[model samples]
Target: MKSAKAKATNYKACLALEVPAYVAFYKAPPEFLGDDALTIEVKYQGGRTEIQKITVKVSAPGGQQKI
Candidate 1:
């Protein structure tokens, strides 16, 4: 387990990629979602663990759609 002292609050994030692509994560102020596959996991300092998986199709801005 990773040890981290609690101040006012704390944050935890981890990323794993099976196939190589591109990934971007936004936090606070101008937060945004992605248009591709991603996985999010949240574990308390020493409590419950919650995970979420998102699947999305991606394409070029002005390219032909996949059929």
Candidate 2:
């Protein structure tokens, strides 16, 4: 499927009775460690918009490994 970018103000006249669905994926680099964050902007069909910030912590694996 193709993705299109549209402005929220353009759909101000539109409305939705049901919630929309979204799919997202995230992966950290193998050498990455410490604090990470993700910022997300959500636009509703009614033209309302919301911004969310999520923080994530990455640390080295603990415990012993057996062969």
Candidate 3:
């Protein structure tokens, strides 16, 4: 069995993608969802609005991870 500290460390290393808007939608039926998987609206440098979608998969860590 893993030690308590080791388990805590392992969980800390794991990263989860959290999108407040998509949380509720993800729980809903797929038919009601839109084409965009995960979208984040941000204001660019010059007061321009832009929408960006990031595709991510939840998986166990084997090697290095991206931020």
Find the candidate with the highest TM-score and give its number: 2
Please tell me which predicted candidate would have the highest lDDT against the true structure: 2
Could you give the candidate ranking by lDDT, starting with the highest?
Answer: 2, 1, 3
RMSD of each: 14.6, 11.9, 13.1
Q: Distance from true position, residue 67, model 3, in Å? A: 8.4
Q: Which sections of candidate 2 miss by over 4 Å? A: 1-20, 62-67
Predicted candidate 3: what Cα RMSD to the true structure? 13.1
**Residue 57 CA displacement from its true place in model 1, Å:** 1.7
> What tens-digit string does per-residue lDDT give for candidate 1 at 18-47?
333334443322333335556767666689
- Kindly indicate the candidate among 2 and 3 with the higher lDDT: 2
Per-prediction TM-score to the true structure, in the order listed:
0.33, 0.54, 0.30
Cα lDDT tens digits for candidate 3, 1-67 = 1212212233465654433332222332444423334666776668999887765343344433221
Superposition error at 10 for model 1 (Å): 28
Model 2 weakest 10-residue run by lDDT: 1-10
Number of clashes recorded per candidate: 0, 0, 0
